[model samples]
Target: MLADYIHFMKDDFWFIVPALWFIGYACKRTPFIPDWLIVWILLCIGVLASCFFYGWSVRAIADGVIATGIAVFSHQIVKQTSARDQIE
Candidate 1:
Protein backbone atom coordinates (compact mmCIF):
# COMPACT_ATOMS: atom_id res chain seq x y z
CA MET A 1 0.00 0.00 0.00
CA LEU A 2 2.79 2.39 0.94
CA ALA A 3 4.77 1.53 -2.16
CA ASP A 4 1.76 2.12 -4.37
CA TYR A 5 1.24 5.55 -2.79
CA ILE A 6 4.88 6.42 -3.30
CA HIS A 7 4.64 5.38 -6.93
CA PHE A 8 1.54 7.46 -7.47
CA MET A 9 3.22 10.45 -5.86
CA LYS A 10 6.19 10.12 -8.17
CA ASP A 11 4.07 9.65 -11.24
CA ASP A 12 1.42 12.38 -11.25
CA PHE A 13 0.05 13.23 -7.82
CA TRP A 14 3.03 15.46 -7.05
CA PHE A 15 1.53 18.31 -9.07
CA ILE A 16 -1.85 18.08 -7.38
CA VAL A 17 -0.33 17.92 -3.91
CA PRO A 18 0.84 21.50 -3.88
CA ALA A 19 -2.41 22.71 -5.33
CA LEU A 20 -4.40 20.93 -2.63
CA TRP A 21 -2.04 22.26 -0.01
CA PHE A 22 -2.53 25.79 -1.17
CA ILE A 23 -6.25 25.31 -1.20
CA GLY A 24 -6.14 24.22 2.43
CA TYR A 25 -3.86 27.08 3.34
CA ALA A 26 -6.11 29.60 1.64
CA CYS A 27 -9.15 28.14 3.35
CA LYS A 28 -7.70 29.33 6.63
CA ARG A 29 -8.30 32.93 5.60
CA THR A 30 -11.98 32.60 4.87
CA PRO A 31 -14.44 34.24 7.30
CA PHE A 32 -17.65 32.51 6.31
CA ILE A 33 -16.88 29.25 8.08
CA PRO A 34 -15.23 28.27 11.30
CA ASP A 35 -11.48 27.80 11.05
CA TRP A 36 -11.62 24.11 12.03
CA LEU A 37 -14.06 23.29 9.26
CA ILE A 38 -11.93 24.63 6.46
CA VAL A 39 -9.34 21.89 6.34
CA TRP A 40 -11.87 19.10 6.69
CA ILE A 41 -14.03 20.47 3.91
CA LEU A 42 -11.07 21.01 1.64
CA LEU A 43 -9.89 17.50 2.37
CA CYS A 44 -13.21 16.05 1.25
CA ILE A 45 -13.09 18.15 -1.87
CA GLY A 46 -9.55 17.04 -2.57
CA VAL A 47 -10.52 13.39 -2.30
CA LEU A 48 -13.53 13.85 -4.55
CA ALA A 49 -11.36 15.67 -7.07
CA SER A 50 -8.86 12.84 -6.98
CA CYS A 51 -11.64 10.45 -7.87
CA PHE A 52 -11.92 12.24 -11.20
CA PHE A 53 -8.41 11.15 -12.03
CA TYR A 54 -7.89 7.90 -10.16
CA GLY A 55 -11.47 6.67 -9.85
CA TRP A 56 -13.34 5.68 -6.70
CA SER A 57 -10.61 3.70 -5.10
CA VAL A 58 -8.78 3.66 -1.79
CA ARG A 59 -5.67 4.96 -3.47
CA ALA A 60 -7.45 8.10 -4.54
CA ILE A 61 -8.61 8.91 -1.04
CA ALA A 62 -5.29 7.92 0.47
CA ASP A 63 -3.40 10.12 -1.90
CA GLY A 64 -5.71 12.98 -1.17
CA VAL A 65 -5.21 12.54 2.59
CA ILE A 66 -1.45 12.27 2.25
CA ALA A 67 -1.30 15.40 0.15
CA THR A 68 -3.51 17.25 2.59
CA GLY A 69 -1.43 16.08 5.53
CA ILE A 70 1.76 17.27 3.89
CA ALA A 71 0.29 20.68 3.22
CA VAL A 72 -1.15 21.09 6.71
CA PHE A 73 2.00 19.85 8.38
CA SER A 74 4.20 22.20 6.40
CA HIS A 75 1.89 25.12 7.14
CA GLN A 76 1.97 24.39 10.86
CA ILE A 77 5.73 24.02 10.83
CA VAL A 78 6.22 27.37 9.16
CA LYS A 79 3.75 29.05 11.47
CA GLN A 80 5.35 27.64 14.59
CA THR A 81 8.87 28.40 13.45
CA SER A 82 8.03 31.95 12.55
CA ALA A 83 6.30 32.50 15.86
CA ARG A 84 9.33 31.17 17.72
CA ASP A 85 11.69 33.34 15.71
CA GLN A 86 9.68 36.46 16.51
CA ILE A 87 9.76 35.60 20.19
CA GLU A 88 13.54 35.20 20.11
Candidate 2:
Protein backbone atom coordinates (compact mmCIF):
# COMPACT_ATOMS: atom_id res chain seq x y z
CA MET A 1 0.00 0.00 0.00
CA LEU A 2 2.71 2.43 0.98
CA ALA A 3 4.84 1.49 -2.00
CA ASP A 4 1.98 2.06 -4.41
CA TYR A 5 1.31 5.51 -3.03
CA ILE A 6 4.98 6.39 -3.12
CA HIS A 7 5.34 5.20 -6.70
CA PHE A 8 2.43 7.36 -7.85
CA MET A 9 3.44 10.43 -5.84
CA LYS A 10 5.59 13.18 -7.33
CA ASP A 11 8.52 14.31 -5.23
CA ASP A 12 8.24 17.89 -6.48
CA PHE A 13 4.82 18.19 -4.89
CA TRP A 14 5.97 17.38 -1.37
CA PHE A 15 4.25 20.52 -0.15
CA ILE A 16 0.82 19.28 -1.18
CA VAL A 17 0.44 16.79 1.65
CA PRO A 18 1.14 19.34 4.34
CA ALA A 19 -1.04 21.89 2.62
CA LEU A 20 -3.88 19.42 2.50
CA TRP A 21 -3.21 18.40 6.09
CA PHE A 22 -3.72 21.96 7.28
CA ILE A 23 -6.73 22.35 5.04
CA GLY A 24 -8.16 19.14 6.42
CA TYR A 25 -7.56 20.37 9.94
CA ALA A 26 -9.37 23.58 9.12
CA CYS A 27 -12.30 21.69 7.64
CA LYS A 28 -12.39 19.39 10.65
CA ARG A 29 -12.68 22.29 13.06
CA THR A 30 -15.41 24.05 11.15
CA PRO A 31 -18.87 23.30 12.50
CA PHE A 32 -20.85 23.71 9.31
CA ILE A 33 -19.14 21.07 7.15
CA PRO A 34 -20.07 17.50 7.85
CA ASP A 35 -17.31 15.04 8.66
CA TRP A 36 -18.01 12.82 5.67
CA LEU A 37 -17.50 15.61 3.16
CA ILE A 38 -14.00 16.52 4.28
CA VAL A 39 -12.31 13.80 2.24
CA TRP A 40 -14.20 14.76 -0.89
CA ILE A 41 -13.35 18.41 -0.37
CA LEU A 42 -9.71 17.52 0.10
CA LEU A 43 -9.81 15.31 -3.00
CA CYS A 44 -11.15 18.15 -5.14
CA ILE A 45 -8.59 20.63 -3.90
CA GLY A 46 -5.74 18.15 -4.11
CA VAL A 47 -6.58 17.08 -7.65
CA LEU A 48 -7.03 20.63 -8.87
CA ALA A 49 -3.87 21.86 -7.21
CA SER A 50 -1.78 19.04 -8.61
CA CYS A 51 -3.35 19.47 -12.02
CA PHE A 52 -2.43 23.14 -11.91
CA PHE A 53 1.14 22.21 -11.17
CA TYR A 54 1.57 19.29 -13.58
CA GLY A 55 -1.07 20.19 -16.14
CA TRP A 56 -4.30 18.24 -16.56
CA SER A 57 -3.57 14.54 -17.03
CA VAL A 58 -4.24 11.12 -15.54
CA ARG A 59 -0.89 10.97 -13.80
CA ALA A 60 -1.46 14.33 -12.17
CA ILE A 61 -4.79 13.18 -10.86
CA ALA A 62 -3.28 9.98 -9.48
CA ASP A 63 -0.54 11.92 -7.78
CA GLY A 64 -3.07 14.24 -6.23
CA VAL A 65 -5.16 11.37 -4.87
CA ILE A 66 -2.08 9.67 -3.46
CA ALA A 67 -0.98 12.88 -1.78
CA THR A 68 -4.40 13.40 -0.27
CA GLY A 69 -4.48 9.79 0.92
CA ILE A 70 -1.14 10.15 2.63
CA ALA A 71 -2.23 13.33 4.33
CA VAL A 72 -5.47 11.85 5.60
CA PHE A 73 -3.87 8.54 6.55
CA SER A 74 -1.15 10.25 8.54
CA HIS A 75 -3.69 12.42 10.34
CA GLN A 76 -5.69 9.36 11.33
CA ILE A 77 -2.59 7.60 12.58
CA VAL A 78 -1.76 10.48 14.89
CA LYS A 79 -5.31 10.85 16.12
CA GLN A 80 -5.65 7.14 16.73
CA THR A 81 -2.39 7.03 18.61
CA SER A 82 -3.46 9.85 20.91
CA ALA A 83 -6.85 8.34 21.49
CA ARG A 84 -5.38 4.95 22.28
CA ASP A 85 -2.94 6.48 24.73
CA GLN A 86 -5.73 8.25 26.50
CA ILE A 87 -7.81 5.12 26.66
CA GLU A 88 -5.10 2.92 28.10
Best by lDDT: 2
Question: Per-model C-alpha lDDT, please?
Answer: 0.72, 0.91
My TM-score estimates for the predictions, one after another, are 0.75, 0.89
Best by TM-score: 2
Q: Model 2, 1-88: lDDT tens per residue?
A: 5566776677899799999999999999999999999999999999999999999999899888888999899898889988996877
Q: How many residue pairs clash in each candidate?
A: 0, 0
Task: Look at candidate 2 and tell me the lDDT of residue 29.
Answer: 100
Alpha-carbon shift of residue 20 in model 2 (angstroms): 0.5
The residue-by-residue lDDT of candidate 1 on 34-77, one tens digit each, is 88897787688777777778998987888777766666666777
lDDT of candidate model 2 versus the reference: 0.91
Q: Give the 10-residue window scoring lowest on summed lDDT in candidate 2.
A: 1-10
Q: How close is each model in CA RMSD to the real structure?
A: 3.8, 1.8
